[model samples]
Target: MLEKDRFFEKVIDRIDHLDRNGLKNLIENLQQKQRVLQLVFEALDEGIIITAEDRVVTMNNVARIILGYKSRQYGNFQEMDKYIANWGLWNILKFLHGEEDIRKEFTIHQQQEPKYYLVEKRTIEDNLVLYKLVDQTEKKKLQFQLKNIESVAALNTLASGIAHEIKNPLTAIDLHTQLIQRAVQKNLVCLDESILQYIKTISHETKRLNQILNDFLLAARPRQLKLSFEDINSFVQELLLLVKPELEEKNIALREEYQNIPKNFIDKDYLKQAILNLIKNAMDAMEKSSLKILTVRTWYDNGRDSTAIEIADTGCGISPDQIQKIFEPYYTTKEYGTGLGLTITYKIIKEHQGEIQIQSKPGEGTSFTVYIPIHKGHKLLDRPL
Candidate 1:
């Protein structure tokens, strides 16, 4: 027993007599390691929350950001849960408290904009659970947008096939109707005014039907772009001139805000047609309005490496519900609208590897913005001035 006591005394004496500077260095190293671990925790994109028993040990910055919690370095899950319950995360806390590990995707709709999340939980030790969360809102939105684009493309193909089959039959009907009308007028048959009117009506209706089918066909088929480098500003000026007379007739004021920008690679004919259709639609929307104004603006978007043309109208704006479906095929608000014009415009912009977006507020106005890449196969400097 005396030898054992001597060994314990020596061990205590050795630790007590350790070098001061060496102990200081060891302490500094340990503090540095803790700082590095904290930095790594904050840098992670995934949110991490760790709890010891009922108290919160720590939460990373990412977790704080994703959860919109202000206290990052100092807060317990229990304390966070007190306020975070408003964010609808209380159920997740309950899951963490359970015995089984948890992995699930859930949506929080309590906020202004719904958010999606993937939550994973595992028991780290006695009565401690580690929860990892990923904000999947943007990722899910992208997936949904991709799915919509694929659906629209498939529908366009189906519409093209159906439209192609009906074209020839429609042409034959129209030709026969015209021939009957001509025969009636030529006195080939003793037909009354009513009979002649009926024949004329058939011709008119067939022509209208043919126009609708033509629109679908145009949207469905792949377009071979006749790419020409042209000044977008000048092209837009030329287009406005064609619609000036119509605008004046309706007492609609046309405002132009044109900026001198670089030339763009585009299919001149296709782009012109698309812009004209938008202008026509704008004019139609303003026909019944007391205050009519059309604004067209052009500028270069250097960030996107494209040129933007925005057509805005102070006419009847589209409803929020209808705005989402405006580009959908066969969906229209106009009485005689084929609902294919905007769809075709969308397809044209997409073919040029561009983007089109619309903003509208009911009873206020609407704007359509189109972005076309400035360079396709040619460098920006090489293009004409």
Candidate 2:
């Protein structure tokens, strides 16, 4: 019996030793995995943020650098304010705190400029939230650049078609005017005032037609931007004043939401003209609408490093099909519409390395958003004078 008991004790001791070795190995493996994860997190290029419950637990270097956060420790919510101000980090944080699923592209106004990010949120252990922010600023600009190229090409084609189709009629009109003038000269005394008035009308219309052709050609061709610094807030205020009389005639309510933003490098004259053209279009659209409200707002987009002007009108909005073709030359719904106004507006904005987006619904309203870069060097497309 003593021999059997000793044997059992030895076996138990051996089993205990093996269990201790296995536990040690498991701990080392876990530590190795943690170290590897830390290294991988540091080396990542995209911004990655991990939070334990509502407090930031760990954030990668890229997240800190890209988001302009200098501190590695952000466990305290209050400590995050300084860096979060510019990144609009509070937006995501708010959503996370609410335990809402956020997987979308969101624009955050950072320092008066708009920054876009593809933010994805996932929860770990039902408490920690991980937010991944991918900067889409450059990608969006590239997309705009591509669209501008397409627009320019279309403009070139339109210009060629206009020169061929419209110039002959203009020439014919000019020759007819000259012939009428010569005939009048030969029979001055017989010419009645009514007949003379008719001739004057013809001559005046001919001159106006010639001017329209000139505008079309100018709009179609590449323009050399005359860059200048201007305060957009003051510029917008002055511009609204000029159109105040017109708005009053239509009983339109003008609303201005102007943010005090810094000056932008822009061609003041061209930009002013473009904005005026847009306002005119809005007025035309509102002619028959029940509500005549024109809202103009200006702000800066920090993410894109640009200034933006948004003109919204509670007018008879455009149909989806017509909206796409609105930029095409001579494509107009109005009987007397030249259709080149918006085209020229598009050209000027593109040359300024800017973007124009229109949102409209038939019988609802229309909003035209124009984005202009703050720096003159942001020329994605060349516009030669």
Candidate 3:
């Protein structure tokens, strides 16, 4: 009994000692822990807020910034509460109260700016709620841009269809006009050569107008591909033969590097038009260069199930800023350019399930690489034995 009483006395003494310094040290340790947590919260890029059962207890600098609260006024959570009342944060808080792991993307009006925030709420062990805010403004902006591009592309397609329908009749009218003017000129019946010249001028102007319309129509329409298994080497050789005279006239040196490429599934006529436009653009850009060298290269890109054809030029390169906008319709840097060639080229390539990539720099040169898928079907000329 005496030993038991002695042990109880020792325990009482120890408890008394713990009452003094132990409480003081415990308070200090908690303060230090809070300071460390504050530092960590301030260092993070994402905004963070910690709320007690009734009110917000702590918030990071980023959170203050996102909430449009100044550093000096951060201690007052009531002001932030009032500001967020209209922004649907109050509703989020209500949801967080009931839910365990909550996530939502919501728009908040802070300082007159409509900011998109991805809000994540997690319930801590102590019943405190941790709210994380991530800004999605840039993501939303990119989405808007993509939507606009799609709309523009659809409009371009519609325009092309209308242009195609108009072109055939325009061509017929142009031809008939030329024939009538020629017959009138041959029959010199009481009319001077000036009158005949006026008729000829009408025919010439109509022809030019027809050409412009045709170019515009082609730009707006999606091309129908006549799928054929074409030998890349033979196709390119034939294309060069057609453009050889023009290149020679311009004194541009032509270089061909044909790699062993598999048969490509392509619309021959549309592919020819695309290549023709690219080569023509290259040749035109080389008019001011000292040594004009146009390189046409074809090879298979092994990493993909397709073939790539590259048309590079040693002419003046396009500007960096202008490169992205080059595919946009009616956006041109040339004096006499209709600005639809590259746009049409892009459309045609897209229809073929192909890709066109351009690399250029000012005064250096430009290269356009086109990738077309290999046809998985039998060759056009292959017959059953």
Candidate 4:
């Protein structure tokens, strides 16, 4: 009976040892997983923070920088709470603790600048709360710009309707005025020379008005694009030739940097009009500069899968406040300007399913870039200058 009891005791002792080994292995595995999770949090671009019930437990480096608390220790809840409260992050904390699911985006004013953030909070197991922050200031700015574009587009449609209704009558009036002037020139019956001169001036001014209306109508209306395959470099070169005399008279140096561009789809006439408007604007902007220089460049933008045409000028750059309104119809900074040039340019580029972007700073010059897609079966025409 004693030997049997000893044998049973040895078996029980072996079982206990095995159980201890299993627990040690499980603990090591859990530590490895925790280390991996920490590395992942550090590597993420978006800021991340974790809280255990009411205290800050951990934060990634991105979170530290975003909150302007880089020197803070990992689990410093009291200090973090202070900073968060000062920066208006207390609302976010309340949302996390509350019963509501919190996901919101808002702008925080910082030193006269606005920073946008997308905040999200979710509760995980063990009463842990995770807070994620995404910076979206630039994206928000772009969205605002796009909204402005849409408003302008709607205005363009209304203007097009008005212009179409008025154009026919204007044309008829111009024709009649010209005919009456011709009759006066031929008859000269009891006609005072001053009256004749007045008639001639009226006729000329009417024709000028007609021409301006035509330009406005063209800008407001959708263009019928005659797409063709053509080398963008050659196309721009031809355009430069047409504008060479004007540039030469102003003493503006024309610089061309053409990359090896593949054949792209474009409408010859419409593309020329857009390019011409851009170059003319550049010339006008540089009128007062000591070195009146206009640079034209064409290249492929790999990220966009499109061809880009850039017109840059060493000119009196636009003010930041006024830059946003430059593309609006009938908005001009120059005297005797119709303000239709840029409006027309923008419309034509949009018709081509392209995008136009302008970057300018006060006293730093400006650059206008137009990006158009590259596709097959586009058309090109050689027009007489």
Please report the candidate that would top lDDT against the real structure: 1
* Candidate 2's TM-score: 0.51
> If scored against the real structure, what TM-score would every candidate get?
0.68, 0.51, 0.68, 0.60
Instruction: Return whichever of 1 and 4 wins on TM-score.
Output: 1
**Model 4 CA RMSD to the hidden true structure, in angstroms:** 8.7
lDDT of 4 by residue, 1-385 (tens): 6975885586567656657766677568668977998899899988888887777788798777777664556554555555552265545555456555478887777777688888888777667888888878888889999999899889878877887778788788778777777777688455788987887787787777776787788876765678777789999999899999999999999889999977787888888998898998898899888878899999998877789999999999999889888887789989967888898899888877789989997676899999987642232233212
The alpha-carbon RMSD values of the candidates against the true structure, listed in the order shown, are: 7.2, 17.1, 8.9, 8.7
**Candidate 2: clashing pairs of residues:** 113-301, 113-302, 114-301, 114-302, 114-303
What are the per-residue Cα lDDT tens digits for candidate 1 across 148-174?
Answer: 999988887887788888889989999
Better of 2 and 4 by TM-score: 4
lDDT of 3 by residue, 241-285 (tens): 999999999999999999988887677888888888899999988
Over 4 Å off, model 2: 1-191, 376-385
Candidate 1 achieves a global lDDT of 0.83
lDDT per residue (tens digit) for residues 204-312 in model 2: 8887787678668757776677766678988888888999998999999999998878887778788888899899999999999989999999998898778889999
Greater lDDT among 1 and 4 belongs to 1
Per-candidate Cα lDDT values, in order, are 0.83, 0.81, 0.78, 0.79
Q: Quote the lDDT for 350 in model 1.
A: 89
Rank by TM-score, descending?
3, 1, 4, 2
